[model samples]
Structures are given as structure tokens and as C-alpha cells.
Target: MIQDRYSLAFRLYPYARSADQDATDPVRHPVVIMGGGPVGVALALDLGLQGIPVVVLDDHEGIGQGSRAICFSKRTLEICDRYGAAGPMLDKGIAWTLGKVFHDDRKVFEFNLLPEDGHRFPAFINLQQPWFEKFLIDRVRQAQAEGAPIALRGRNRVDAVAPRDDHVLLDITTPEGPYRIAADWLIGCDGASSPLRGMLGLGFVGEVFKDSFLIADIRMKADFPTERWFWFEPWFKSGASTLLHRQPDDIWRVDFQIGWDVDRAEELKEDNIRRRLDAMLGDGVGYDIVWSSIYTFQCRRMERFRHGRVLFAGDAAHQVSPFGARGANSGLQDVDNLGWKLGMVIRGRAPEALLDSYHEERAHGADENILHSTRATDFITPKTPISHVFRNAVLDLAERHAFARPLVNSGRLSVPCSYDGLSLTGVDGLGGPDRTRPGSPCPDAPLGDGFLLPRLGGDFVILAIDAEAPETMTQDGVTARRLAVSAAQDPSGALAARYLGAAPGAVYLIRPDQHVVARWAQYDETALRAALRRACAKE
Candidate 1:
């Protein structure tokens, strides 16, 4: 039997119990992540790469079973590559180049995501979450083998969390025994039923859809195209919607809508589920069911991502329907956004106020994802007769109208969202040609030898065409470099104009997370240094 371990049961107090208990009485980390899920693991890897110590705790013994959130976007793949996990992930996952949308047993629209020339990674890849988790575990182990101290505490549950002015006190239970950890910052990546978020009194605000979905992974014998994802409307006699995608290992994942009124227990029964699959696929196909479960969709987000020293991330902060594959992808982006900022702050390179930007930027992104997913869910699952008719009409129009293709395809995929409300996005007061905005993601441009913007290397970058180097641009504070991309050598004018604009001489200050903090048409060392000071003060 797998007995649940209980190591610690410490209580919250204003002061430490004792100062001279042991050699390692209470080890404190710059950052502690609660939840060993993908987001937590990814964040740990990111922070570890930046030489920051992190502790990741999860109640589960290992990765959750079955294929979940198999779609990996281009941005997510780039992040994985940055952390050195992309090789295994790419080798294990199936790369998909095309997607097809169907209506009334006919192909309504299709999307070919392999762009002519933009993204570095493919449009998407289908990977089972369990395999992905194994890849992450291997990466974490490899990092540890190299003397990086990233502690993975599986079978350990956080009992309580107390926020302090300087750090957070965590009471956790592991097989070894009950232990307490004090961290400079605590991140809650513990999923929907997050204990940390609840403890902080942060409300998850949004609506839970009425319909529940049954997801199954089965080894089926069929000639279905592996590159295509099929969505069936009025899928069966029961009027459930069905989605099927081919996965790695010759397995296929099927998601079927089981109306809100159905019993979850009955739906999870193997024989009952297999019978339904047989009825839908029509008898002759041989198959064996690997796994099956039911889950309801929710478009909820936390009222506040940060409460004092505790921060919420991933599903703990927001949950969106799986229709668009936004849930896991967006969570990864959250970690990407927070990891470097946390590292900079911990290293005294940025001010504490920089922490607040995590909530500001990520919450806006989460809300956008929720809105998109909710609309997609509504389009896919029409609750009323009027909605059903309208949905069919839209599909019918999409079948014939060329202009309607992008709109129909947007419902099932994810895209990069802009950060408009960021203060560092210097849109208003910057005296440039209006091309370089503050808070905008640093635009990528071709350098004399390699790429220009993303070369910041997990730190702040200051790009100047002809500005005198500020004294702080040295290694004393943040790392800053000058990028001089001449228009005469502009291979791609569009990308060059994106960062340099029409100005012959300009300076752009990029944050550690690669967002433009401030921009100027001419060299202004004073303004540039002041911006660096503000960014550094965020630690």
C-alpha cells in the first residue's frame, strides 16, 4: 500500500521556535515553489539556471497518469529549449504541422501553421504530460548532478503557509518527517484546489461551465491521419461533442462531452466507456482502453495573483477550458515571466516593486486566456437552441468564406498576448518615432552574426545604436550591451523596423524578461541609467 507520509505539523507563529536547533535548523531559499507539476518544475529549472536555489513540493508521488494538454505552442517550445529540455521533449513528442476543423461530417476549415518565415519552433507538438514530466524530472536530476541544489520533494504536502515581511514560513510534511522551510518568496503552482491561495483569502473569480468532459486514451486500430485533430459536433446519439487526436506510442486521446446531468462515476466505468467508444467508432475496429476520466471545464481566475509574499501561478491562479489548449501553455508563460524577475530580485539586482509586475502582466494574460477559452467553449457547446443555430450558421459561412478562415481557426489555438498596462512599456512619454513602446516584448532582429533581442541571457539588456555606455552597464549591476543593426544589411526589413524603427540611432532598454523598459531615438545616458536604476530597484 502507498502510505501517505506525514513529516511536519508546525504551526504559524510570529517568531521562530528556536534559533539553535541544528546545523541546518531551517534552510531558507530565495524562492520556494509549492507543487511539483510542470509549471513548478519549469520555474525551478529557470531559476536554477540563473543560479538561484529552489525547493519544489508536491503531494503526489509521481507525474499524473494519461495524456493531458498534449499541444505545445511555439513559445512554450522556445522556453523549454531555453531550459535545455526541448531536445528530449521534441524527440518524444509528435510534431504536427496541420490542423483540420470539421462540421456536419465535412471539412469546414483547415490551418497550416508552418509559417513561411517567422517562428523558431514549429507551430505545435503533441506530447503526453506524463512523458513530459519524466523529461523534466530527468533535467532536474541532471542539474542536481552538476551541483545545482534544486530539491524535488514529492510525497510532501504543504500543511500551512505564513507570509513574513522578509520571507514566507512553510509547514510541510514529507516521509522523512515534518519540516519547516523559510523562503524569500513562495509561489503556489498547486493547481485548482490550491491550499496556499485559499489560505491567503484570494478568490478565484470566474464561471464554471455546466458541461463535463470525459477524456480517454486508448490503443485503437484505425487509419486516422495523425497530423489532424478532428472535432465532431452532435458527435453521437446522446448529442455529445467529440474531439480526437493521435498521440505518441500509437495511442489516441478522445475527449467526449458528457452532459452536466450525467453521473461521473458511471461515465468513468471502463466497460461503459468502451461500449460508448465502440458505438461511436462502429464495431470492426480493434482497440484497448488505456485510461479514462471525467473533468468539468472552468474559466476562472484568481482575484489577485499575489497576496503579500505568496504568489499564485498556473491553474492555482486561473483555469481555462481545454478547447484551446490555453491552460498549461499559459501557465508555462507565467513561470517564464516570473522566474527571471524572482531571480533578479533575490540577487539584489531588482527592487521588490518589480514583484508586483508579475500580477500585473500575468493576470492580464490569464484573463485574456479565460475570455478566449470561454468564448471557444461557448462556440463549441451551444447551450440553447438559438446558440446552436448561430453556431451552425457561423460554421456554414466559414466553409465558403475565405476571410472567415482565420476567425474559425483562432478558436482552437493559442497566441501571444500583448502586455498593454505595463509601466515599463514606455508608450506615452518616450520621445521616439512611436515605434518602440515600453512594456512591449523586445522585438527580435538579425544581428551581424546572430539574433539580437533574445540574446540577453536571463538578464537585463540595453540596446544602443550610438549611445555612450552608462557606468552601470558594466557587470556591477545588470548586464547591458549595444546592438547596432544597420539598415543597409537588413535582410528582413519588417523585423529590423520592429526594434530599430525608422530612426538611424536609437536606444532600447530591455528587462530581464525581455520586455522593453524604455526606448529613445537618440543616446540619453542619464535616462537610460535612470531606467536601469528603476529596474534594478525592483529587486
Candidate 2:
């Protein structure tokens, strides 16, 4: 019998228990993060990379149960790569970009998520959430070994939050006892149903689906490819949807859209699970159910992520249905956006108002995710009979008609959210691909034996494409280096095709978080510096 144990827990991180502290006074930290999950750990590593001290408190001692959040997006992989976790993750992940949609007996259109190849990583990969967390934790520990200022305190739960003018105080309950601490700035990556959110009495508003889905990770010697296969009313199961994915260690992740009013306990039984597997994989196909779970879909977000000196990220700030793999991916982007800006605020480089961009940017991301997931859920499990008939018609049309294929949404795969017209978006100096424009993630291209994303990460950079390299450009604690590019720099001309198009002598100003802020037809030092200031919220 596979015992359900949180036994994957890592060793305890030593921390002092301070039960006695004046209500007005507490030991202060630069950044106090509540939640040591992927989002919290990513924030800690990002702050540590900037030499900023951060304290992470989580009630759990180790990684969470089951193979949760299985699909990792390209943007997420890029962020993980920046934090030094991608190498291990890539080694243990099953990379794929192809997905086929099956409508009962007929096969609908298949998709190649990333048809082109200049980027360093694939469109998506499947890895257990626990393994991904362990990789990020290992990176955090490595940074700690190298004297990075990060303290991860496991089994430390924040019980109270007292937001102040300049700092936020936290009352924590530990395994040993209760204690209090303060932070110059507080961030809650605590996840869905966050204690910190409840303590602050924030509103999480969104839609909830009526149907429940079952996730079962099975170990079997079947011929399932790494590619994703989503079905609608396949004969092997009930008249519902099913998703198949391959993960590490020969494990297959199967999600069955078990309708509402199901006997969850009975369905989760080993006999029932094995019976379902037998029906799907045939009686002769040997398999073992490793993990099984049933969960209702929800699409919700807080009214605001920033509340005084305390902020929220990840599921604490917002949540989406698990359809698009946006929950964890968007949360990682939240850390990517907040980490640099928060570090700047701590270093006195940018005004505290810069943190507002974190809320603006990530809330935008959350909205996009929620919108996509809600649409997917509605299509997957139509509340009305008319909606279900329409969905079936779309599927039937998708089988033969190319135009109808665009209407099909087997979870409209996760993608980066663009901040095109936000307050920080500078001038779009030239035209480019839809994804390579201002306020978008930089389009990756091959750079001298490596890719462009690694080089673009960690700092604000100005790329001098087909232009003279600028001598120097610096703004409020932000320095921009000129990286000259030529036809020789990109032999495949992908960089030019994506960034410059037909325009020559173009330059782009990229933010520290790797989002394109502005571009210029020519590298004007004055305009470049101004854009840098605007990007950092110092203008």
C-alpha cells in the first residue's frame, strides 16, 4: 500500500523562536515572504540574486503531495533558467510541443505549439510539481551556500499581520512556539486559500465551475507519447473530456472530467481507478495508479494585490482554473516582475511607488489567465445544454474545416501576458512581430553558441541592432549596456526578423525583468535614459 506521507519533507531549517516581543517592536527584515512554495522560493532566489535579504515562512516542512501543476510553460522555464533551476528541471522533464485533440472516434486538428526553433527551451514540458519545487529549493540552498541573504524557515506559519506605515508586522506560530517579526516590505506567496489573505480580510472574487475533475498519475508500460492528447467523449470513459500527459519516471498523468455530484470517495478508490485504467488502456495493459485526486475548478483573483506595505503574488494574489497551466506559470511571472522592482525599492534606487507596477503587471497577467481558463472551462463543461451542443458542433467542424480549428480550445496553452499600453510602456519605435513589440517579452534568438534570454536576464540592457553602440547610458540606479548585433551575430536572421523586421539602426530598451520597455529608430542617449527611468517608475 502506497502510504500518503508528507515524508518527502526536507530537513528543518534552524530558526530562533521569539515568543516574547513588544507589540510595537520586532526584529525587522527587508522582505518577509509568507509561503515557501514555488512562488515564494522564486522570489527569495530573485532577491538573493540581487543581494537583498529575504525571509520565507511556510507551514509545511517540504514539497506538497501528488504530481500537481504538471505542465510548465516556456516563459516559466525561462524564469526558472534565470534562477538556476532549469538545468535540473530540463534533465528530469518530458519536453513536448505537439498536442492532438480527439473527438470520440474522429481525430480533430493537432497543434505544434512552437514550430520554429531559435528559442532555448520548448513550448512546454511535463514535470511533477514536487520535483520542480525541489529543484528551486536546491537553487535557493546553493545561493545560501554562496552567502546570498535568504532564510527559509519551514513549519513557520504566519498567524497575524499588522500593516504599518513603513513596515508590516507578522505574528507567527512555529512548531516550538509563537513569535513575532516585522518586515520593511511583506509579500504573500502563500497560495490559494492563503492565511495571510484571510488575515487581511481581502476579497478573492471570480467564477467557480460546477464540474469536478479527477487527476490520476499512473505508472505503466504503455505506448503513450510525450505529446499531449485531449479528448471529448472518448468511448473508454463517460461522456466527458480526458487529458493525457507524460511525466518523468514513466508516469502518465490522466485527467478525467468527472461531472459534479460524483461520489469522490468511491471514484478515488484503487479498484475504481484500476478499472478506469483498464478500460482506457485495455485489460492486458499492466498499470499501477500512483496518485489520484478530485478537485473543483475555480477562477478567482483579489480586488488588488497591493495592500499598504504588504503585497500578494501567486495564488495569494489570484487564481485560475488549472486548464492553461497559468496558476504556477503566472505566479512565477509575478515573482519575476516583483523581485526586481522590490529589490530596487529596498536599495533606494526607485521610489516605493515602483512596487505599484508589480500589482499592475501581475494583475493584468492574472486577468488574462482567468479569462482564458474561464473560457476553457465553459467550453469543456457547458452549463447549458445549448452550449454543450455548440461545443460539439465546433469539435465536429474542427475535424474537417481549418477555419473552425481556431475555435477549438483544449486549454488555450499558456503564453506570456504583454503590458502594451501600461504606464511604463515607452514608445514603440518600430514595427515587429506581435510578440516582439514594446511591453512584451523579448523574442529569443541564437547568440554566440547560446540563446538570448540568458544574456538579457538580470539587468536592463539596450540592444544596438544594426546601429552604432552607445558609449554609456545610466539612470536612477539602472545602467544600460549596448549589445551590438549584426548579420553575423545571428546567422539565421531570426533576431532581425523578430526584432528589427525591415527597419535598420533600431535599438530597444529592455527592463531588468527582460520586458521590452521602449525602442528607438536610432539610439538617442537622452531618450534611452528617459525610457529607462520610465521603466523603473522613477520618471
Candidate 3:
């Protein structure tokens, strides 16, 4: 176990006797989260802020030791920003925009993820997974202090789960004893090895590559730039491929693509790992190994994320190779897509049918991630000699030819998946910028005081850009207020460029998740009402 190598680094929520544990009858909750990882805690925070009660059950108290996931995409940072937790993350994370791909000792090609300006966040940030979870928990604490209805129970392991027609029952084992609880809605954010998923007799179906990678997080004072550097058949001759990334606290993550046939026990030896490091860093370059582990990833997901009243998010629903940083980023996107829809349903503002869209939309996302991950894995580890020759040819061309640069895939870093043509999407009559089309996440732009996204907030909003709209409108028991901003508010003209291309003005109906559901050149009350209904699945 990885935990055995490290002490209890964080005991944020030690076990304590809960009133529910003593209840004669099983206590009931509106929503119960199975795991307290980043996705679980973020969901709790999202729901808690919306006045929804959520209880998170975890076997352990706080973050475990390891620089588990270090790369976070900009879309994830934007989502975290909406939860008010991105501040701490951005403050502590090492932001990077450049990525360099090398073939052997020579650089094949380099690319910049975020070339344009006016956005609030960079392309990516490198921060240890533990710090990311801690920042989220800290926000949860602050929210709790402000009377948010969120509960975190540590050392509470859910041993069994019973699915009912309307709700799910959970049998929890705590340090004190055992207790039973029922949840109106149960969320499985457990992980890849999801116990809740197994307890329900569910399984993931997809492909698992036969290659392995060794990740060594070392504490060193090296003068390496904060960029993603990937090497194919590195000159150091340590492994087939190598990846380097910088994190906070002078910690650097080094990934070596060791072959599958190697002996795990032999490779994990301290002397063997040190020999590889010595070859890469040159002799006498001292460093301390913070954490090291070998991981083999799979591109798989459940056929359905929702089963009756129980829904799976994060690794419980889907998993992918860590190549693109899609594992955690896509999981958070699942929470973002589900949080608002679930909130509305629990509050009786939307029908239960709305929950089905969570499976539909997020399943689509999971499939997309799996496809990309599989391709990247195949490219990084060619299964046959012909494929290897083709990959090498593309790499050689990328060094000198501009068109072949696109063919080089050193893991297509995570990008937000557009939900175009999906069920919840509405009409895009405005014909404005394609980036802000229906079912697409609203892109960040610079406004007068701050950025454009923070102003949208977390709710169904009518974003009126250089257009007239009502102050607030209620449709089907759900209210959507208008945020009127003019092109003049942004001196950079990014607002007009992103939301309104050559059009005179535009009006957009944004979902609680900040995804565009409908848009028009002029505000029409009747159309807006119908769009709101469709967005809530009332149509």
C-alpha cells in the first residue's frame, strides 16, 4: 500500500461519534458521497453552496502522501474558480504554457497551449494532488463555518450498498461500530478501484494497455523551466520514454516509460531508481526521492454512470490514462455537469428525468477521454514494428515540417469537451462565435473589473451582451437573472470578440454549470422561457 510508505500526513477529519451512528433507525440524507477525494469534496462544496445537504464518507481522514496528480488543465481551474477554491490552488501551483516534445536527444516540436491573452488562468498548473484536495477541504471548512449544509465523516468506510427504486441504502463501518444510512441520491466518487461500484456488481468495460510507467517525485534544486518536457527514447537510456514536470516546494515529477516485461520488484529497488536518476541528472547531482511508484493505466468506463438513484462520478464512472491529465480533469467536469442538474431536481425545480442527461452527457465525455487516451497510449507505446516506424517517421517530420507537427501527439493535454447536439442543448440562433455555441462552456474574457466568468456566477443566467434583457425571469419554477454587459466594458475587445463576432449584439441562456444552452441576436422572452424549460428537461 502506498499509505504504508508515508505517515498520516493529513488528519483533517478524524473519526468522531456522529448522532446518526446511534440512531435506532437508519438515518437519511438528501445526498451521500462515497469518497472524500477531490471530486467528492468538490461536489460537496458545490452542493453545499447551493443549500443542498451532502455527507461525504471516507475511510481515511485527509490527503495521503504522494505527488499523485500534478497537472491541472485550465478548464479545471476555471471550474474550481467557480467554487471559490482556485485562489489557493493558483497561488501554490506552478503555471506553465509551453510543452516540448523530443525525439531521442533532439527536439522534435514545441507547442504553446495558451497563446492568446485575456483569460484569467494559464494553460496548466502543476500542483501535487494532496495540496489540491487540501485547498478544497479548506474551502469546505469555510463554507461550513458560514452555515453550509455539508458533513465530512472520516474513518467511515461503506461496506455495502443497497439500491432501492427511489433511494439507496448504505451500510457504513466506522471506528466505533457499524451503522446503516439511506441517501435520497448516492454519488460514487470513490476511485478507479471503486468499492461502491463493485458492491453494486458493476464493471468497467474498455481497453488496458500492456505498458507501464514509473513515476518518481524527487525534491531537488534543479534549474528546470516550468514546462512539460516529453522525450521519446531518451538519450539517458533509462527507459523507452521520459516526461518531466515541475511542482511547488522544489518537487519535480519524472515519469519513465519502463516496458511491461520488466520485473517490478527489481525496478523499484532504491539503487535501480538512483541509477536511472544519476544517468539523467549526471553524477553527483543530489536529490531526495519524495515518492516513487509504478502505474499501469486503462481506458475504461461504465456503460452507464447512473443506476437508479445512484450515480457515479470521477474514476468510479470512468478512467483514462494519465497521459492527457484527463483523469482528474474529466472527473471534475462530471461533477460540474451533474451538480446543477442534481441540485434542481433535489429542490423540486426540475423533474427526475433531468438526471438521465447526466449519464448521457458524461458518458459521452467518458468515451471521448477513453478514445484520446487510447490513441496517446498507442502512440507512446507502439505495439508493432510498423506502427513504431510510422511513429518515428512522424516525429522526424515534425522536427522540420510544420504540417507534421500536428501529427506528433505527446499526449493531447486536456481540453474541455463540447456537448454540441446533445439533448439539453437548445437553439443557437445568434450565429455568433463558434466557441460560445450552444452546449459549449463559456470562454473566459476580460471585463471591466475582473474576468468574465466570475461575473456569470453559479446559476442559470441570461448573459445579455450589448443587448436588452429583463432583470430576472422565472420559468417552470426556476429563475434566471440577466447579467448585462456591453462591449465597451472590456477595453481589450475580448468580450465582443468572444461572445459577439460581427453580430450587433447577442443574448445567451447559460446553465448553472456555465454551459451555453441557447443564444439569440435579440432577447425574446418566449424563446428564453422555452430554452430554460429545455435546459431543465421540462420540455
Candidate 4:
């Protein structure tokens, strides 16, 4: 029998207790990831890439149900590329750049995601969450075949979690029996309603939006442009706002704000779904509903992501309203932020203090994502009578005036959060342009007909632009790879202009995760090494 492409099940091997040892026998690993979701699997791959041994435990045998997270951002694509899954994703996912907003019946404004010319990935890709997870699982399997030292154990549910000062203990229940395992570091990627988070006694804090949303994914044969279209109080839906997005396989992901008092069971009935679809998409439109779900989200996060040797990443640590596609994107960023630091600490290449920066930076990222999503949620569904009036006024004014257009916020969309003035490197380094600031993601540009980010992440790099490569950079026991960019590598001069506007020579100290640590107008080895140490959290 052939496996369903949408729902692929992998065989689950039993983790039976040893004949001599009972369930009390403690099997230990360096890093044990608690969820086999995208964040956990990505972290496993990232650690495996760094030659760190890991064990990933998942209760489910395969990917989750439905298209959970559909929008994949450019930064997210880059991160996936590093983990060897972006190529398949870009090919299979629907790549879109343009978006149109509507108020009532008039198409208010057309906006672009500001996609550039040189980067390999587009601004965004609309793919089902299941497909994305499948891709990640494929990469994980490939890594396992290549001896990455990663154990992906399916159907192994974590029953209990005990955090120690030095190690974390996990009680895993499988088909054969229940056994206990210990880990040097435990990452909770278990997602919202996370069991590990509850067991750890981490307090979740934030506001829950009063409005509920219904997401409907349907397969339709329509010649609609592959773009995001959102409406505020559309004539068809009267007082509600609706969002329309295109996914792969001629699938359309539609969302409508149904308010808080919805009888979800009644609302999700076939007749109700058909009525809503007919109102917006025409009654005779050739379509088949794939799936639909009602959701009410909260922009909340844990008080702390780090609890001794245990850490939280992805939806387990923070959850934002799904409007901005910040949930999984930010989760992957948390993986990116923590993966390298954890790997280094495990390898004894960096001090345990290095993990502090991960907490600081990811907490900052989670907070930033929460802030943007909260603002979007508020604008989409204002609570106060006065607030709704002002919102209506802004939407009405946006149709006529240019200045009011900027005030409209269907969703701010996920953007890279600048880690300026943080404990890791203090502030954004003195840079050529604001784009190349410290704590910002390394910009991807045409480099020798390829891209810049491909060669940057997974290691420390000293990018010397239009200047001689810095002298053998051996900084604080670790050596940095020196990249020399010339007119040839940066054929169109876009990279040079972005990194070295008018400056004669420039050096950017990039971290293992491809974040700019420091940039100097000139290459001074001493200053560069000191900056590297600061980035590594070595005072």
C-alpha cells in the first residue's frame, strides 16, 4: 500500500527496558529534544550538524494534522536552507510577494513584501505545515543515514519531566513500557498546551484576544493571483474581517473573524461553511473543502525560557496570534539562537555562560513577535467602542489618503528583530548601513553566482568586504573563517554597496548562527577578536 503524501507514518521502534535494568535505568544523552515538531527536529538537525549527539522523542508517529502554519518567511527559508530543507520547500510551496487589502467592496491598497532581486528565496512561501514537517523529517532521516548521531524515536511520549541543576530527567512512555532517560539539556518544543511546560511549572503570561477565527482550507480551481488578500468589514461578511491566502495544490486558506461567542460546532457545519464560501467566493465556484478549524489565540510567553539545564523553544516558550505567521517562524529563530550555543557548550568549546545570551536574545525575539502580533490582533478586532470607531475611521481614511494607508494593520508580518543594545555585544555595532547592524541576520546577496547566507551560518565568519581578508583570525581558542568579497564575487556590486557603502575596508564578525556580532570601518585584528569574545559571552 502506498502512503498518503499528506499524512506519512513512520515505523515506531520500541524502547524496551534492558533485561538486567528496570524502568529505573537511566539512559543519558547530551541533548534530548522533547517534541518532534519542526522546532525540535530543526534543533536536532542543527545540533547533529554541529556533531552533537541528540535524541528526539515524539508521541506521534508523523507530522501533525492539517495545515497549521502556512506562511514561511524569507528568514525562515534561510534557516531551513541551513538545515537542508529549503530547496524542496521553495519548489513545492507557493511563492508569493504581493498582497492586496480591501475595505467593504473597494480594493483599498496594493502592497508588496519588498522582495529583492538577488536573494535565493522569496519574501514568503505558502505551504501546509504538514509538508514542511515532512521535509524536515526527510532531512533528519538523511542526517541519520549520514551518521549524524541523532535518534528520532517516534511514539515515545514524555510522561514526566524533572529538572536538575546540572541535568534534566525525562520519563518516556512507549509501546513496550515506560522508561526513564536523562539529558544534559532539555528543549521543550511541545507547542501550545505544552505538557512539559506545565510539568516544569513555568508561568505563561499575556493577553488572550476576545475574537475567534475560523480557518478553512479548500482545493479550488480558480485563476486568482497568488497573493495575500485581507478585508476589513467586507460587505459579504458584514461586520467581520476576512483573509484569503493561496497554498500549494490549488488550496486556498481562508480565515474570517467570527467573534468570541461562536457556537463552533454549529459554525463549522457544512451548510454554514458553504454559505460563507458562497458569499465571498461565489456559490458556483468549483471547490472542495480540505479542512477547517476554529481557533482563538493569545499572545503569551513564559516568564523565563531557561530553567537550569532545561530550555524552551517555539510555541512552548511563546505563542503569538496566528495573524502574522510569527509562531513557527519565531520558534525556528529560537532554535537558531539556541542550537549553536547549546552545541558549543556541549562540545566544551564555549563556557556555560554562553547559554545566557540565548535566553536574552530569544526572550527578546519572543517579546518582539508577541508585540507585533498583539498590535495586529488589536487592529483586527478592537474591544472598546471608541477603539472600533477609530479603527473604522482609519480604514475609511486609508482608501482616500496615502498617510492613512500606513496605519492599516491586517498583520505587520514577521520581520527580523534587531538585537541592538543587548547583553550579547551590548548594541548594534558601528556599521556601514542600518541593515548590517550587529544582532541583525546576515543579509543574503549574490555572492559568486550563489548567495551569502549559504556560506555564513553554522560557523563564525569574518566577512571582509572590498578589503584584504583579516590575518588568520584565531580568537579566544576558536578560529573564524575569513571571507574575502571582491567585485567578482559581488558581480552587480549590491553586496559591496550593502556592506561597504563608501568605506575603504570593512570587517563583519558574524556568529555561528549568521548574526552580525560587530562591523568595523577598518579591519583591526585586536578589536575584532575582542568583539568575538564578547559575542561568545566571555568577559
How many clashes show up per model? 15, 0, 0, 1
Ranking of models by lDDT = 3, 2, 4, 1
Location of the lowest summed lDDT over 10 successive residues in candidate 3: 1-10
What does candidate 1's lDDT look like per residue over 290-384, in tens digits? 87878887798887788777888999999999977798889888988888878877888677777787888898888889888988888778879
Q: What lDDT tens digits, residue by residue, belong to model 4 across residues 353-431?
A: 8888888998899888888898988898988999899998998888889999888998988877878878766333444
The order of the candidates by TM-score, greatest first, is 3, 2, 4, 1
Error of 1 at 181 (Å): 2.5
What C-alpha lDDT, on a 0 to 100 scale, does residue 49 get in candidate 2? 83
Candidate 4 lDDT at 506 equals: 81
- Steric clash count of candidate 2: 0
lDDT, each prediction: 0.73, 0.85, 0.91, 0.84
Model 4 global lDDT (CA atoms, 0 to 1): 0.84
Which scores better on lDDT, 2 or 4? 2
Off by over 4 Å in 2: 1-25
Estimate, for each residue in 496-519, the C-alpha lDDT of model 2 and write its tens digit.
788877786578888877899988
Task: Return the TM-score for each candidate structure.
Answer: 0.86, 0.96, 0.98, 0.95
Q: Between candidates 2 and 3, name the one with more favorable lDDT.
A: 3
Give the clashing pairs for model 4: 421-427
What would you estimate as the lDDT of candidate 3? 0.91
Model 2's TM-score against the true structure: 0.96
lDDT of 3 at 3: 23
